[model samples]
Target: MNASRLTDHTGYWMRMVSNAVSQEFARKVAGQDVTVAEWSFMRALYDLEPVPPSVLAEKMGMTKGAISKLAERLLAKGLVVRTENKDDKRAHSLSLTNEGRDKIPVLAALADENDAEFFDTLTREEHETLNRILKILAERRGLDATPVD
Candidate 1:
Protein backbone atom coordinates (compact mmCIF):
# COMPACT_ATOMS: atom_id res chain seq x y z
CA MET A 1 0.00 0.00 0.00
CA ASN A 2 1.14 3.55 -0.69
CA ALA A 3 0.11 6.79 0.98
CA SER A 4 0.36 10.30 -0.39
CA ARG A 5 2.51 12.89 1.35
CA LEU A 6 0.84 15.71 3.30
CA THR A 7 1.69 18.29 0.65
CA ASP A 8 0.10 16.22 -2.09
CA HIS A 9 -3.34 17.65 -1.39
CA THR A 10 -4.60 20.86 -2.99
CA GLY A 11 -6.32 21.81 0.27
CA TYR A 12 -2.99 21.65 2.04
CA TRP A 13 -1.46 24.24 -0.27
CA MET A 14 -4.57 26.39 -0.22
CA ARG A 15 -4.56 26.38 3.53
CA MET A 16 -0.90 27.35 3.57
CA VAL A 17 -1.55 30.41 1.44
CA SER A 18 -4.82 31.21 3.18
CA ASN A 19 -3.34 31.10 6.65
CA ALA A 20 -0.55 33.46 5.66
CA VAL A 21 -2.84 35.92 3.97
CA SER A 22 -5.45 35.75 6.71
CA GLN A 23 -2.99 36.01 9.56
CA GLU A 24 -1.27 39.03 8.02
CA PHE A 25 -4.55 40.78 7.32
CA ALA A 26 -5.71 39.99 10.83
CA ARG A 27 -2.58 41.64 12.21
CA LYS A 28 -3.02 44.74 10.06
CA VAL A 29 -6.65 45.14 11.11
CA ALA A 30 -5.75 44.50 14.72
CA GLY A 31 -4.16 47.93 14.67
CA GLN A 32 -7.71 49.21 14.22
CA ASP A 33 -8.79 46.99 17.15
CA VAL A 34 -10.98 44.97 14.81
CA THR A 35 -10.77 41.29 13.99
CA VAL A 36 -11.01 40.11 10.39
CA ALA A 37 -14.50 38.77 10.98
CA GLU A 38 -15.54 42.08 12.49
CA TRP A 39 -14.05 43.92 9.56
CA SER A 40 -16.00 41.68 7.20
CA PHE A 41 -19.15 42.30 9.18
CA MET A 42 -18.69 46.05 9.16
CA ARG A 43 -17.83 46.08 5.49
CA ALA A 44 -20.98 44.16 4.67
CA LEU A 45 -23.06 46.52 6.76
CA TYR A 46 -21.40 49.48 5.15
CA ASP A 47 -23.03 48.44 1.93
CA LEU A 48 -26.40 47.68 3.47
CA GLU A 49 -27.35 49.66 6.53
CA PRO A 50 -30.59 50.49 8.26
CA VAL A 51 -31.03 46.74 7.95
CA PRO A 52 -32.54 44.34 10.39
CA PRO A 53 -30.32 41.81 12.07
CA SER A 54 -32.21 38.95 10.41
CA VAL A 55 -31.61 40.40 6.97
CA LEU A 56 -27.99 40.96 7.76
CA ALA A 57 -27.62 37.38 8.93
CA GLU A 58 -29.04 36.11 5.67
CA LYS A 59 -26.88 38.36 3.57
CA MET A 60 -23.71 37.45 5.44
CA GLY A 61 -24.52 33.74 5.50
CA MET A 62 -24.24 33.86 9.28
CA THR A 63 -26.61 32.66 11.93
CA LYS A 64 -28.84 35.01 13.85
CA GLY A 65 -27.00 34.28 17.07
CA ALA A 66 -23.68 35.07 15.44
CA ILE A 67 -24.95 38.31 14.01
CA SER A 68 -26.47 39.24 17.33
CA LYS A 69 -23.20 38.66 19.10
CA LEU A 70 -21.23 40.71 16.59
CA ALA A 71 -23.84 43.44 16.76
CA GLU A 72 -23.60 43.55 20.52
CA ARG A 73 -19.86 43.95 20.38
CA LEU A 74 -20.05 46.67 17.76
CA LEU A 75 -22.81 48.36 19.67
CA ALA A 76 -20.79 48.32 22.86
CA LYS A 77 -17.87 49.74 20.95
CA GLY A 78 -20.05 52.68 19.93
CA LEU A 79 -19.55 51.81 16.31
CA VAL A 80 -23.20 51.14 15.54
CA VAL A 81 -26.61 52.22 16.70
CA ARG A 82 -29.86 50.31 16.87
CA THR A 83 -33.14 52.02 16.23
CA GLU A 84 -36.44 50.62 17.38
CA ASN A 85 -39.35 50.89 15.06
CA LYS A 86 -42.08 53.09 16.43
CA ASP A 87 -44.93 50.98 15.19
CA ASP A 88 -43.46 47.59 15.95
CA LYS A 89 -42.21 46.84 19.41
CA ARG A 90 -40.08 43.86 18.37
CA ALA A 91 -38.71 45.38 15.19
CA HIS A 92 -35.46 47.27 15.07
CA SER A 93 -32.67 48.05 12.68
CA LEU A 94 -29.01 48.96 12.87
CA SER A 95 -26.78 51.49 11.19
CA LEU A 96 -23.22 52.53 11.61
CA THR A 97 -22.37 55.46 13.82
CA ASN A 98 -20.55 58.40 12.32
CA GLU A 99 -17.31 57.05 13.72
CA GLY A 100 -17.92 53.63 12.23
CA ARG A 101 -18.72 55.11 8.86
CA ASP A 102 -15.56 57.18 9.05
CA LYS A 103 -13.45 54.15 9.84
CA ILE A 104 -14.73 52.17 6.84
CA PRO A 105 -12.38 53.85 4.39
CA VAL A 106 -9.43 53.52 6.73
CA LEU A 107 -10.16 49.85 7.37
CA ALA A 108 -10.68 49.34 3.67
CA ALA A 109 -7.27 50.86 3.05
CA LEU A 110 -5.74 48.36 5.42
CA ALA A 111 -7.49 45.55 3.56
CA ASP A 112 -6.16 46.88 0.25
CA GLU A 113 -2.68 47.15 1.70
CA ASN A 114 -2.86 43.61 2.95
CA ASP A 115 -3.83 42.33 -0.48
CA ALA A 116 -1.01 44.17 -2.16
CA GLU A 117 1.50 42.83 0.32
CA PHE A 118 0.63 39.21 -0.43
CA PHE A 119 -0.73 39.19 -3.97
CA ASP A 120 1.47 41.76 -5.66
CA THR A 121 4.04 39.02 -6.20
CA LEU A 122 1.77 37.65 -8.90
CA THR A 123 1.83 39.33 -12.30
CA ARG A 124 -1.30 41.20 -13.37
CA GLU A 125 -2.56 38.34 -15.51
CA GLU A 126 -1.72 35.81 -12.88
CA HIS A 127 -3.61 37.77 -10.25
CA GLU A 128 -6.60 38.11 -12.51
CA THR A 129 -6.59 34.42 -13.32
CA LEU A 130 -6.27 33.48 -9.68
CA ASN A 131 -9.15 35.73 -8.69
CA ARG A 132 -11.31 34.45 -11.50
CA ILE A 133 -10.62 30.87 -10.53
CA LEU A 134 -11.40 31.57 -6.91
CA LYS A 135 -14.59 33.34 -7.82
CA ILE A 136 -15.63 30.45 -9.97
CA LEU A 137 -14.98 28.01 -7.17
CA ALA A 138 -16.92 30.21 -4.76
CA GLU A 139 -19.88 30.47 -7.07
CA ARG A 140 -20.02 26.78 -7.82
CA ARG A 141 -19.75 26.01 -4.13
CA GLY A 142 -22.52 28.46 -3.21
CA LEU A 143 -20.13 30.32 -0.99
CA ASP A 144 -21.12 33.78 0.08
CA ALA A 145 -18.65 36.68 -0.19
CA THR A 146 -18.88 37.29 3.54
CA PRO A 147 -15.22 36.49 4.16
CA VAL A 148 -15.95 33.89 6.80
CA ASP A 149 -14.01 31.06 5.20
Candidate 2:
Protein backbone atom coordinates (compact mmCIF):
# COMPACT_ATOMS: atom_id res chain seq x y z
CA MET A 1 0.00 0.00 0.00
CA ASN A 2 1.23 3.49 -0.83
CA ALA A 3 1.70 5.91 2.05
CA SER A 4 0.13 8.76 0.08
CA ARG A 5 -3.20 7.02 0.34
CA LEU A 6 -3.07 7.36 4.10
CA THR A 7 -2.13 11.01 3.81
CA ASP A 8 -5.81 11.79 3.39
CA HIS A 9 -6.52 10.53 6.90
CA THR A 10 -6.54 13.33 9.47
CA GLY A 11 -5.03 11.27 12.29
CA TYR A 12 -2.12 10.17 10.18
CA TRP A 13 -1.27 13.70 9.09
CA MET A 14 -1.89 15.16 12.55
CA ARG A 15 0.50 12.73 14.21
CA MET A 16 3.17 13.21 11.58
CA VAL A 17 3.02 16.99 11.74
CA SER A 18 2.61 17.15 15.52
CA ASN A 19 5.58 14.87 16.17
CA ALA A 20 7.87 16.66 13.74
CA VAL A 21 6.92 20.12 14.94
CA SER A 22 7.07 19.21 18.62
CA GLN A 23 10.52 17.60 18.32
CA GLU A 24 11.91 20.70 16.66
CA PHE A 25 10.18 22.89 19.22
CA ALA A 26 11.69 20.82 22.01
CA ARG A 27 15.10 21.49 20.56
CA LYS A 28 14.49 25.23 20.39
CA VAL A 29 13.35 25.28 24.02
CA ALA A 30 16.24 23.12 25.27
CA GLY A 31 18.60 26.13 25.24
CA GLN A 32 16.21 27.88 27.64
CA ASP A 33 16.47 25.11 30.28
CA VAL A 34 13.03 23.53 30.02
CA THR A 35 11.70 20.23 28.81
CA VAL A 36 8.68 20.12 26.51
CA ALA A 37 6.46 19.00 29.39
CA GLU A 38 7.62 21.86 31.60
CA TRP A 39 7.11 24.36 28.85
CA SER A 40 3.60 23.04 28.32
CA PHE A 41 2.75 23.30 32.02
CA MET A 42 4.14 26.82 32.19
CA ARG A 43 2.22 27.85 29.13
CA ALA A 44 -0.95 26.44 30.61
CA LEU A 45 -0.41 28.47 33.75
CA TYR A 46 0.04 31.54 31.65
CA ASP A 47 -3.38 31.10 30.11
CA LEU A 48 -5.14 30.50 33.38
CA GLU A 49 -3.68 32.37 36.30
CA PRO A 50 -4.04 31.08 39.85
CA VAL A 51 -5.28 27.68 38.82
CA PRO A 52 -5.19 24.74 41.20
CA PRO A 53 -3.10 21.66 40.54
CA SER A 54 -6.23 19.62 39.91
CA VAL A 55 -7.39 22.10 37.28
CA LEU A 56 -3.93 22.09 35.76
CA ALA A 57 -3.94 18.33 35.53
CA GLU A 58 -7.22 18.43 33.64
CA LYS A 59 -5.99 21.17 31.38
CA MET A 60 -2.70 19.41 30.63
CA GLY A 61 -4.31 15.97 30.27
CA MET A 62 -1.80 14.87 32.88
CA THR A 63 -2.09 13.08 36.17
CA LYS A 64 -2.38 14.99 39.45
CA GLY A 65 0.80 13.35 40.70
CA ALA A 66 2.66 14.48 37.61
CA ILE A 67 1.33 18.00 37.93
CA SER A 68 2.30 18.09 41.59
CA LYS A 69 5.84 17.04 40.75
CA LEU A 70 6.17 19.64 38.01
CA ALA A 71 4.69 22.31 40.23
CA GLU A 72 7.26 21.50 42.88
CA ARG A 73 10.08 21.78 40.38
CA LEU A 74 8.81 25.09 39.05
CA LEU A 75 8.40 26.36 42.58
CA ALA A 76 11.98 25.42 43.38
CA LYS A 77 13.09 27.30 40.30
CA GLY A 78 11.20 30.37 41.54
CA LEU A 79 9.12 30.38 38.40
CA VAL A 80 5.82 29.59 40.14
CA VAL A 81 4.26 29.82 43.54
CA ARG A 82 1.57 27.91 45.35
CA THR A 83 -0.77 29.55 47.79
CA GLU A 84 -3.70 28.33 49.82
CA ASN A 85 -6.99 29.41 48.37
CA LYS A 86 -8.69 31.77 50.78
CA ASP A 87 -11.98 30.04 50.31
CA ASP A 88 -10.57 26.55 50.50
CA LYS A 89 -7.35 25.88 52.33
CA ARG A 90 -7.37 22.32 51.12
CA ALA A 91 -7.05 23.50 47.53
CA HIS A 92 -3.97 25.43 46.59
CA SER A 93 -3.89 27.84 43.68
CA LEU A 94 -0.86 28.16 41.45
CA SER A 95 0.42 31.22 39.67
CA LEU A 96 3.54 32.27 37.89
CA THR A 97 5.82 34.39 39.99
CA ASN A 98 7.66 37.36 38.56
CA GLU A 99 10.02 34.84 37.06
CA GLY A 100 7.35 32.51 35.71
CA ARG A 101 5.32 35.37 34.30
CA ASP A 102 8.35 36.82 32.58
CA LYS A 103 9.48 33.57 31.03
CA ILE A 104 6.18 32.88 29.28
CA PRO A 105 6.34 35.77 26.83
CA VAL A 106 9.88 34.86 25.94
CA LEU A 107 8.90 31.25 25.40
CA ALA A 108 5.88 32.35 23.39
CA ALA A 109 8.12 34.39 21.15
CA LEU A 110 10.30 31.38 20.65
CA ALA A 111 7.19 29.46 19.66
CA ASP A 112 6.46 32.05 17.02
CA GLU A 113 9.98 31.74 15.72
CA ASN A 114 9.72 27.97 15.62
CA ASP A 115 6.48 28.15 13.69
CA ALA A 116 8.00 30.55 11.21
CA GLU A 117 11.02 28.34 10.80
CA PHE A 118 8.83 25.42 9.82
CA PHE A 119 5.86 27.04 8.10
CA ASP A 120 7.30 30.18 6.58
CA THR A 121 7.19 28.61 3.18
CA LEU A 122 3.42 28.35 3.26
CA THR A 123 1.36 31.11 1.72
CA ARG A 124 -0.81 33.24 3.99
CA GLU A 125 -3.87 31.52 2.61
CA GLU A 126 -2.36 28.13 3.28
CA HIS A 127 -1.60 29.12 6.83
CA GLU A 128 -5.13 30.34 7.36
CA THR A 129 -6.60 27.21 5.88
CA LEU A 130 -4.42 25.01 8.04
CA ASN A 131 -5.37 26.93 11.15
CA ARG A 132 -9.03 26.73 10.33
CA ILE A 133 -8.89 23.01 9.77
CA LEU A 134 -6.83 22.38 12.84
CA LYS A 135 -9.13 24.47 15.00
CA ILE A 136 -12.07 22.44 13.84
CA LEU A 137 -10.30 19.24 14.79
CA ALA A 138 -9.30 20.67 18.14
CA GLU A 139 -12.86 21.72 18.86
CA ARG A 140 -14.21 18.36 17.84
CA ARG A 141 -11.70 16.54 19.99
CA GLY A 142 -12.40 18.86 22.94
CA LEU A 143 -8.80 19.98 22.97
CA ASP A 144 -8.17 22.97 25.17
CA ALA A 145 -6.72 25.43 22.72
CA THR A 146 -6.79 28.09 25.40
CA PRO A 147 -3.66 29.02 27.31
CA VAL A 148 -3.48 27.47 30.81
CA ASP A 149 -2.40 30.57 32.68
Query: What is the Cα-based lDDT of residue 56 in candidate 1?
Result: 94
lDDT of 1 at 70: 91
Candidate models: Cα lDDT each: 0.90, 0.84
Candidate 2: tens digits of C-alpha lDDT, residues 41-145: 999999898998989888878789989988988898888899997897798999999988888888888899989988888999999999998889788988863
- Misplaced by over 4 Å in model 2 are 1-10, 86-89, 145-149
Root-mean-square deviation of Cα positions for candidate 2 versus the true structure, in angstroms: 3.5
User: What stretches of model 1 exceed 4 Å from their correct place?
Assistant: none
Ten contiguous residues with the weakest lDDT in model 2: 140-149
lDDT of 1: 0.90
What TM-score does candidate 2 get on C-alpha atoms? 0.80
Task: For residue 11, give model 2's deviation from the true position in Å.
Answer: 3.2
TM-scores of the candidates in the order shown: 0.96, 0.80
